[model samples]
Every structure is written in structure tokens, then in C-alpha cells.
Target chain A: MRAVDTGGYLKGRIRREDIISAAAVVYGEVGYHGASLREIAKRVGMSHAGLLYYFPTKEALLAAVLERRDAEDAEREQLDSPPGLEVLRHYLALASHNVRHPGIVDLYARLAAEAVAPDHPAHEYFKRHYDEARVGVRDSFRVLAESGELRAGVDPEQATITFIALMDGLQVQWLTTPDAVDLVGSLRFYLQALLTVPL
Target chain B: MRAVDTGGYLKGRIRREDIISAAAVVYGEVGYHGASLREIAKRVGMSHAGLLYYFPTKEALLAAVLERRDAEDAEREQLDSPPGLEVLRHYLALASHNVRHPGIVDLYARLAAEAVAPDHPAHEYFKRHYDEARVGVRDSFRVLAESGELRAGVDPEQATITFIALMDGLQVQWLTTPDAVDLVGSLRFYLQALLTVPL
Candidate 1:
């Protein structure tokens, strides 16, 4: 058998990462609809065809970009398997992190909104994304409620929906009027309103 | 002197309203980027040139569509001159109203998110819109705080931002998973958490 080209595979993986990073920036600047694959390729200093070899379609590139974001959040924040209080804290930290990185937040806010249409390329992805997100947060709230850390009379499911919505809504407002909106501060206020223990 | 042509003017006004309504549906379906003037004109059963005579540009039509939505909300909910407690109640009602009218909600969510890009046609429009929205909500919360109706230790400005964000965020979530999300219920939950006075 022919020997595998480990160096070429490694280089290909790195090139894919570069392309995804460039796509995230371009998508933030012009939105997914307004973004051009050619521009993203140009940003990464690759030929359009070369970029397409890595990401065969704009939609595929978008998926990679979004996946990379989720992977980063999971890796950095330990968001994949968080405890109840930690979940709340992580979200607050996330708000702060998003404030520091406006590009991905912009990309997310725009794509989430655009994908609400049933026919959008990312529609199923967003629906599943939100479903999983709600379920995860809801479980944390359930844990908080069971331990009496959550405020009395608060439905964990409803609170989860509200909390997720607040995070998303804050992003749009922050993106729109960053000077006027305080993402982390607002999130903390809501958390304080929800939880019995200090975060 | 030329005749005033009152009947013709009324017909023209009616036609313009029809076009705006149709544009709203199209925008909601495909978003602004995916929608076309020709399609909007076709929906209203008018030639594109005829429609352009009224709106001049796609951007102009988008502005009119957005303005009409705001006008409807203001007139129906009396959101323009809202009292402190009434402001919260009206928003809850607004959420309920939005649930029933998915099309408009879809349009607003998509446009608001897309308009976060500075180069978008609706960018300046949304910036001004959110600024005014925050100011309006903030004033109401201020009035509530002065009357001791707002929860103790709740900052009116912070609450105002959270409240606006909640409304916006709920729309996207609701649009994504209408079967799962309760827009009005979540709004009520937050309002109760914020106010000392019962609705």
C-alpha cells in the first residue's frame, strides 16, 4: 500500500480552519446572504477553487464556521457538560466573551434571524440548535429548581426559554447600539432575579 | 386650476396600502435580501414600474413596510404614550399579538437582525428604532421606579434594556420553534419578576 501523506492531511486541516475563520469575519461584515465565497477565499489568500475544495459550498462553509464557534465555546467554557450554577455563570461569562468578540456575535445574530425562514439553508440547523440549547438550559434550571436554588414559582421550562431569548435579544440590541446596551450587566440582573444564591 | 382628483387620490392611496401589505408578506417569506421588487409587484398585481413609481426603490419599500408595522403597534397598543405599568402590560399584549401574526414577527426579526450590518439599507432605521424603543421603555420604568411599582433594587435602565431584549429575543426563538416557545407567557413571567404591582 502507498504511504499516507500525514503532512498533507495536517496542512489541509489547517487550511480549512483558516477558511472558516475568514468566513466568520466576512459573514459578520456583510451577513451570510451578502457574503461572497470569493471574498472569503481572497481573505484566506487562496484561490476560489482551492477554498471550494475545502468547503464545497457557501452553505457548507457556513456550517463549518458555525460548528467552529460552537466547538470553541464548548472547549473554552466547559459548556458541553455544565452544572446548574456553573451554567448560569458560564452564560454570564459568555455574554462578556461575546461583548469582547463582536464578529461571531454579529454572525450568529444575523444567521439566527435569517434562518427563521423555513427555507433558509440554515433553517433546520437553527431549529435543532435552539431545541438543543433550550433543552440544555432547561435541564440546568431544573437542577436549580430541584435544589431550591431557583426562585419559587418559577417554571424551569419557561425560565429556560426566557433566559435563552434574553441572551439572543441582548446580542441584537448590543450589536445595534453597543454603547447603550450592556449585555453582561443585563444577563447578571436576570440571573440575580432568577437565582436565590449569589453567582 | 387642476382638479384635486379626490377619488383618484383615494384609489392611489388604497393601491399603495395594498402594495405595502404584500411587500410585508414577501419580506417575511424570503427576507429582504432574498425578496425582489418584481415579486412584490407581482403579488400586488401591479407592474414593477407601477410599484416603483410609488416606492422608488426596494430600500424605500422596505422603509415603508417597517414604518407601517411600527404605526400599527403604536396605534393598537397605544405604545406611543404608555404609562409605567401599562407599558409592561402592553408589551405582553404585543407579544400575544405577535404570536397570532407570525408573518410580521418573521419580518421584524429578520430585518432587525440583518440590519445590524452597518451597510444594510435598514441599518440607520433600526439604530434609530432601538434607540427610541429603549428610551421609551426606560422612561416607563423610571416612572414605575418613582412610584415604587418596580421591584426594589431593580435599575430601571437595566430592566428596560432587558425588557426590550426579551421582546426581541423571544420573537426569534418563537419564529424558530413556534410549537415549543410561548412568547406571551415568557413576557408575562419577566414582567411579574420585574414589577411589584400585579398586572
Candidate 2:
């Protein structure tokens, strides 16, 4: 019988996470196209070949970075498990959470923009990302509507679209002029206007 | 009196506009960093040197491109001249106008995302651009508030921020999935919710 190298496995996982973190910073600073593997490896004190051993290509590395971001967001917010109004409270909390991590927010903003092109590598990724995002938000709003919690004449689908849009647009303005925006507060204000009950 | 070369001057103006249009297309396709001057020049069927003769540098060309977008928007919407509710109406109209021209909207979205970096070439340009935009929208909302046309408990400054954020955010979603989003309709829905009167 062979013994499992549990310690080594843990080390490898930690090193991989470190690589993803460095890649996020580089991708945030210079975008996906402009980011170089050599630069990302150097940031982590790894050789290009060593980094490739973990992530074979730039696209692979990008996928890891994005996946990690989503995992972290999902775990922290527990956004998927919550239902109806709870989902929205968690979302607002996520905004507050994002304010403290400008690096990830900046990376997301840059990548989402670059992915608008149909041929771009992240295009499909973003398309699916938004789709899942909308569905989750829509389902929650629908629950609210069923209970008569949503205001009169506020369609759940439309409210979902507007809510998502407001989050995205506020990120741009807040990123450009951080002091000028109240990210969480503005979101709360919009929600207050949309819902009949209190948050 | 010496004869004026009016024909030559008109031809120069036409060529300049052609270059700007081509640049917009290229910039919209690839972001500012990824876009090349040679490619833009090639699209216009002009030599690199000839293009430089018109605009001195890449930054200069970018500035011209952004300035031209704003100029055309102001002229078409008369957004700056209107007061109170009319200003919001024109902004909504501008969104409708934008749906017919996805290329420009794509360019603005990409650049706005890229320009989030403090050192980006268009950083200051976007900073001032958003500042002026917020002020224009804010003043109009303030006027509505003063006249009691705004919904109760809605603050003009906060509404201005949310409105701008919604527009910017909706653009990202719309660009990603044009069919899934109702850009102009969403804006109208938000305005309807915020105001005591109809949009």
C-alpha cells in the first residue's frame, strides 16, 4: 500500500492560490491582454516554466483567477443558498465587501469591458456569468413579488435588470472617484424605493 | 482679394472625420491599449505619417475621439440646455439613440473600464467627464426636488448617483447580451419610480 502525500498536496494547493492572487493583481493593473505570464510569475518569485506547470496557458490562468473570485464571493456571501429578500441583503453586503477589495473590483471591471468583443477569450465567460447572475437575482425578486413585498408596478424581471445595472454602473463611478460615491448606501436607497417592506 | 482654398479646407475636414470614425470602430473592437495607430490609419486608407499629421499622438487621437463623442451627444440630445425633467428625458432619449449605435457604446464601456486605472491615459478625461455628468444630472434632479416633482424621501444627490450608475451598469449588460436587455425601457422604468410624474 502507498501512503498519500497529504502535506505535499496542501503545499501545491497553497502555491496555486498564490499564483492566482498574483495573476489577479497583474490582470487588474494591465488587463488580460496586456498581462504577461513572466510578469505574473516574477511577482510570485516563480520561474515562467514553474508557473506553466500550474497553469499551462494565459487563458487557463485567467479562468483560475475568475473561478477563484466567484468561489470566494459565493462562500463569503452564501448568496446562492439565500432566498427572496435575504438574497438582496447579501448582495448589498457584497457591495460593502467589495469596497474593501478594490483590486478584485478593478480586475472585474477591466475584464468585463474587454470581454465585450465576441472574439475575446472571456466573452463567453462573461455572457454566462451575467446570465447566471440575472437568473439568481430574478428568482429572488420573483419570490419577493409573490409575497407582495415588491412595490406596485415593479416587475421582478425589470427590477432585477435595473438592480444589476445599478451595481455595475456604480462600480465605474466609484472606481473613478471613490469619495464621490456611496456604493452601499445608494444600493440601499434603490432597494428601499423598490420594496414595500423594510430591509 | 486673394482667392481662398475652400475646396481644400472642406476636403481636409472630411478626411479628418473619416479618420475619427475609423478610430472609433477600431477602439470599440480593441480597447485603447490593444488598439494600434497603424490599424486605425489602415482602416482609413491613410499612411501612418499622414494620420500623425492630423493628430500628433495616440493620446491626442484618443482625446479627439472622446471629445467628438461628447460633442455629437450634446448637439443631438441638447442635454445641457434642458432643465429639470426635460434633462432626464433627453438622457433617456440618448440611451435610445445609443441602442442604435452599439459600436460607440462599446467603445465608451471599454474605455471607461480601462480608464479606471489612475495612470491610464484617459484617466483624467473620464474623471472630469463623470464629474460633469453627475453635476448636470444632479442639478436637474435638484430642480425637480425643489418643485416637489420628485417622489417623497428621494434625495436628488443620491438619485443622481443611482441614475448614473444604472445607465452605466445597464450598458455593460446590454453590450454583453443585447437581446436580453431593454436599455431604454429600463431607464424609463427607473425614472418612473423616482418621479411623481411620468417620463
Query: Per-candidate TM vs. native?
Result: 0.85, 0.85
What is the DockQ of the complex in model 1? 0.77
Clash count for each candidate, listed in order shown? 0, 1
DockQ of candidate 2, scored on C-alphas against the true complex (2 decimals): 0.78
What overall lDDT, based on C-alpha atoms, would model 2 receive against the true structure?
Answer: 0.88
Off by over 4 Å in 2: A1-18, A25-35, A42-60, B1-22, B25-35, B39-59
Chain B TM-score, one value per candidate, order as shown: 0.83, 0.81
User: Residue by residue across A159-187, what tens digits does model 1's lDDT show?
Assistant: 99999999999999988888888789899
Positional deviation of A121 in candidate 2, in angstroms?
Answer: 0.9
Q: Which ten contiguous residues of candidate 2 chain A have the minimum total lDDT?
A: A1-10
lDDT of 2 at B93: 90
CA error at residue A70 for candidate 1, angstroms: 1.0
Q: How many angstroms is residue A79 displaced in model 2 relative to the true structure, after the best TM-score fit?
A: 0.6
- Tens digit per residue, CA lDDT, model 2, B124-148: 8889888988999999999999998
Model 2 lDDT, residue B16, Cα: 90
